[model samples]
Target: MADSAPDRYVLLLVPSAIRCQCRCVVSHRAGRTDSRLAARCAAVASVGAAVIHFAMSPTHWNDWMPSGVFFAAIAAFQLVWGLLAWWRANGLLLVAGVAANVGSAALWVMSRTVGAPFGPHAGEPEAVEAAGISVLLLQCYVVMGAGWALYRRCRAEEVSAIGRSLVLLGATSIMAVAVTVGLASGLQGHHHGVEAEAGHGPTTDEHLGDHHDEEPTAPGEGAGAQTFDHHSESSVVPGIVVVQPPAAPAAPPAPDDGGHQHDHHD
Candidate 1:
């Protein structure tokens, strides 16, 4: 009877043990799945930021050499990092990403609000434009995803493959819209800047044409030309004409003065 009791207990506990093991396996898988999704989302965000930086680098370079170089370097680093995360994201990489993205986003906010602390444009606040806003949004997403992965919160439930795909699709759509609108806004801004710079001064031909269209001043009307008459010689310039007064008759000879002195001597 004692042997039978032990056997019965062993049989009864087997199912519980099995259930516990299965739950552990499932929980572990769910955690892994959640972490993977976070990493992937972060990777996508990083790649999107890289694309925007790449597109803006040239324009920024045209405005300022340092800004262009900075953008280019950021683009390259983010691209490489994003690819690495996509391939295999580890804790160290996730931490690094979160740190970098947070710093970058902070700097962006500062630039838009107060101004950049250094560089040629120091203390000059930049406008909040579409490209910049898009980049900010992507950076924010990157930070959130990387932080989520690092913390491992909300990992109790398993997300299905379809759900992951939908998430990715939504993210991609947001990035695409941002990139498109941002690029368009940037191009328009550049075009307007060029036009404004060009419009600062009028061309010589246009200025001359404007003056030439005016009616000519009467010859003797102005104080400068009061001595001038209808017969006076004229000088011509591109858009102006000046009349020169005739010379006075040579002083009637001092010859008369020499004759008056000889009469006084007599």
Candidate 2:
């Protein structure tokens, strides 16, 4: 029997902060001071990660980023943030979350407007959809939305922070739907523009340039003259080929006399 290779194990060292957070982010994975709030935070943050995962793909790497790399970053950030939120809202994490969301939203708008840094992603629908979601969650829901809710929760007892979270979710959902419609409309407009450009471009009316043109009917020309007009046509090429019939072979030259010709006697 052949000898089997020994098994080997490899371990990768992760940062303390990330290690701590990872344990916290999983639902019911660890003991938290407030389990209810932790679960809710984890759910939202995990959903953000899932949304980004749906938007991005590993295979989407190209000269132009397939919008996947950007979303991957967001997913990573959300996971970390969710873990932190489970334990408590550390001011640093809150600030980082807000910054990440705002920066991403700005970058998304820039990409759509002028495609800075990475140029553009071949007008991909998936890319556009990803950008729209980023706007909905990070920009609209997290930064603009959750911040205010958290503040209100601190200020008053009448409104529950849960209500704010629900409102934020609703807003994000509405934004997603609206953006989807807008994206469809914009794509349709662009397609029509492309069709118009194709229909009327300088290349569309093109004709083969190499030609032989005959002169207009001459004053004395008859219908038969027109029949022979082909021979007189003006050609782009000055040279013309002429074909002639092969000549009949001449009778073999009168056999050469053998030097003496007999005179005929009368």
Candidate 3:
């Protein structure tokens, strides 16, 4: 009876132990899957940001060489990093990804708000454009995904309210469109506003042409010429005036002229 009782107890504990082990295994697999998904999300976002940077690099090159080179370097780094992350994610890669994206995003915000600290266009606040905003959004997703992958506790909630991959695809499309528009518009800093200002203020040659198209107030009037109109007998032109003498007071008006016709012939 004692042996049977001990046997029964051992059997009961064995099943319980098996169930616990199964649960642990399932939990671990679930965590691994979630991390993989997070890594994929980060990779997609990073690549999207890289595309935007690549698209903008040429335009920035036109504005400033250093800026263009910086953008190109960033794009290349992000592209390689994203590819690596997608293949296999580790703690170091996740941390580096987060740091790079955050720093870039912060720089963008600073340039937009307080203006760039150094450059030919220094001290000039860059206007917020669709492309810039799109990049910011992508970087935000990259940071979130990287953070989630780095910490398992974040897997408690869905990384995205919608499907993560779907959301990333949509965001990537939006960024592509924004970058196209930004390139078409020629960015915001020296392209839009400065060009518009130049357009509004015509050149000296244009001013001369405009003046030529209009009729002048008087003859010999080119610029800075002022003329006054006087009686029909005399003319006042710009810097010169002409006046007719009184004709010796009209010969005293011919002494009332009614007595007789006194004519003077000359």
Candidate 4:
């Protein structure tokens, strides 16, 4: 009878043991999932950081370039997007991230065309070459891909409301960039005009003074006559010898009378 009682006791504990095992398995799986999500978020943030750095490459992380402002704008979006992605602000992150990618692509295209994109007088090969076409295109894919992935997995409540509100910021930034280019071009023109005037002032005066000094000598014909003599002098002499014309034939007797008189005397 004691053996039977022990069997009953084990039977009573079996359910609890099974439940504990199930709970442990569930917890372990949950932990793994959380880790994966965290890792993905970190990766997303890292990509955002890369985008920010690449955008600033033209300006060398400074403001020397006109495109630096556009890059600054992109970096700002990247910062916000990274934070949102980390916090699982899926909606706002998606909204902002896609826009950022579009804007960045546009910026690259602008760089290839004119200095107007970077700033006034920035010119080609300098600002455009700041980031290679392949590298920038790759970045565009990364941003868009990450943003899309986050949006797909993110729940409705994951992103803050602010993200949704600021989604259009990307569009607004482009217009602001255009305005900046115009203003910078104008300023550059004004500055160049001032510099040109300053630079020419002294040079023009010096040139005028030099002309006045040479005025009296300008009409001299000696230079022209000498140039003509030099060209024809070579044709007259192969070496240094000057050829003389043969002596003219002796002149005929001037008068026959004088000749006859000389003959009679002989």
Candidate 5:
């Protein structure tokens, strides 16, 4: 069965939840003592690493260099401040960030082995690269969420922290899965729609042949017949013909740009 509009909308919400989770962690840790100090240091280091990484790459360096620098700087600041305010909390955040990076790098390696650079392409090979990147991002988001949960648990009142963290994690995970699967399904549906349109003309004969073995029904018989049943004391009207129209063609699937796959080449 095809995905519904609501399902696609839910899918688009997944990445947004992931992004919100990342921002929440950064924001929540911003005011903590160890978190502040660690955030600053981490920000600087992240910026430096990003600069070096961008410098090493010659292709579209101008386009990506700024973003790399920005994320690095943000990471460094967030990490330093977070660590300074709350050492344990900041540590969890750092670990999450590191795990995300490692996961992304692993995906990049897999893509290289498969001969698809982390960019758009024409076939399943290209799709594999895209899928790898999506999985990597999802993993990173999950880690960040886990870190945020840890931070919350560390700082909140003992009575409520654990419960709140569990709730947040559960909600985010459901959103993530729903969004990713919905978007992927939507993309697949689009590809199928295109193929169907392109191949529609010649498939009529094939379809007919597949259905040819069904037994023929006599006219005015079976469910196709119009009939009236009358009891001894009942009067019935006749001469009414009921006709069922052919079903309309299904509409093309909508494009989901908001859920567009992230490009994680660097």
Candidate 6:
């Protein structure tokens, strides 16, 4: 009977090996699908963030912070999903990915406010601001691309769709940067012009006032000089009167004398 027990143990080992191989194959297939789902979910989260950033103006951090946190959470979820996928639970990974994306979308919606903190003038043309936003948008694209690549490695489907999505996101991000930079530049120019005009305006007013005062002083000085001239001339000719009427008086006296002589001769 002891010899027979050894034979039975060998028979059991054969069956165990066959079962192990079957389990391995199943696990590998499940892992492949799970990894693909995780990657796709991550890509969707990244694309959503980009859209939120673009559509909103004066994007505020108060609301944006939650979205950022949501992004981090999605990444964590994807890691877990990848692990589950490795363990042959593809369904769990799919569920987790979908849940994460939903959370991300909700966060984006909550962040939308009626007015932007920067008062519609945020993200204007200072090179540093434009450059910072551009870098941020680029990072989003990079993360999405990385996720898509990983997904393709796992699933091997829809290569064209992945490429197209990447291209579209990149182009949109570039256009957004261009528009932001242009607006900022225009605002800066307007501000500078207003400052310059304000600075020069006071100086012009001051100069004009000085000229006006000088003009009044000139007229005052002329009037004083004229008074002095008139006073001097009047003092020089105070009571002088010149007349030449003596010749007329002498003709009147000769007429009276001739009339008396003619009366005596008649």
Please report the TM-score between candidate 6 and the true structure: 0.25
Best TM-score goes to which candidate?
1
**TM-score of every prediction relative to native:** 0.61, 0.40, 0.57, 0.35, 0.25, 0.25
- Candidate 1 lDDT over residue span 114-184, tens digit each: 77888767776777778888888988888888888777633435778898898878878887887787777
Order of quality (lDDT): 1, 3, 2, 4, 5, 6
- True-vs-predicted CA distance for residue 45, candidate 4, Å: 6.6
User: Candidate 2, 98: how far from true, in Å?
Assistant: 0.7
Candidate 5 residue lDDT tens string, 1-266 = 37698899999999999988877775664443233433333333333333333232332233355434544553354344334323343564657555645654564455444532433421223223333344344434434444544455434322244544454455445445544553454334222111234354657878666655445545645474443332222544455443334456656646668876443221
Each model's lDDT: 0.75, 0.47, 0.72, 0.46, 0.43, 0.42
Error (Å) of candidate 3 at residue 104 is 0.3
**Candidate 5 residue spans exceeding 4 A from truth:** 1-97, 105-125, 128-137, 146-166, 169-176, 179-200, 203-266
Candidate 3 per-residue lDDT over residues 204-238, each given as its tens digit: 99977754454346544446543343233354455
Off-target runs (Cα >4 Å) in candidate 1 are 1-32, 153-156, 189-266
Predicted structure 4: lDDT: 0.46
Model 2 off-target regions past 4 Å? 1-46, 63-68, 118-138, 153-266
- Scored by lDDT, the top model is 1
**In candidate 4, what are the lDDT values of residues 1-266, reduced to their tens digit?**
76899899999999999988866664444323332243244335434444544444454434455445555655566666655555554444555666666766665566556533334445542333323343354445445555555544422123334543343243234324433443343223222111234343567878766554432322433442222123255565333333333465654645665456232211
Q: Local error of candidate 1 at 76, Å?
A: 1.2
Tens-digit lDDT track of model 2 for 1-266? 23332221112334666665655554232232232333334335444543444344343333336555765667677666656654555445555766776777777566555454543543432234433543455344556433543443323233256664674466446545544554444333222111234365444234322233455765654454432235455543334332234456655545446975443221
> How far in Å is the alpha carbon of 241 misplaced in model 1?
19
Residue pairs clashing in model 1 are: none
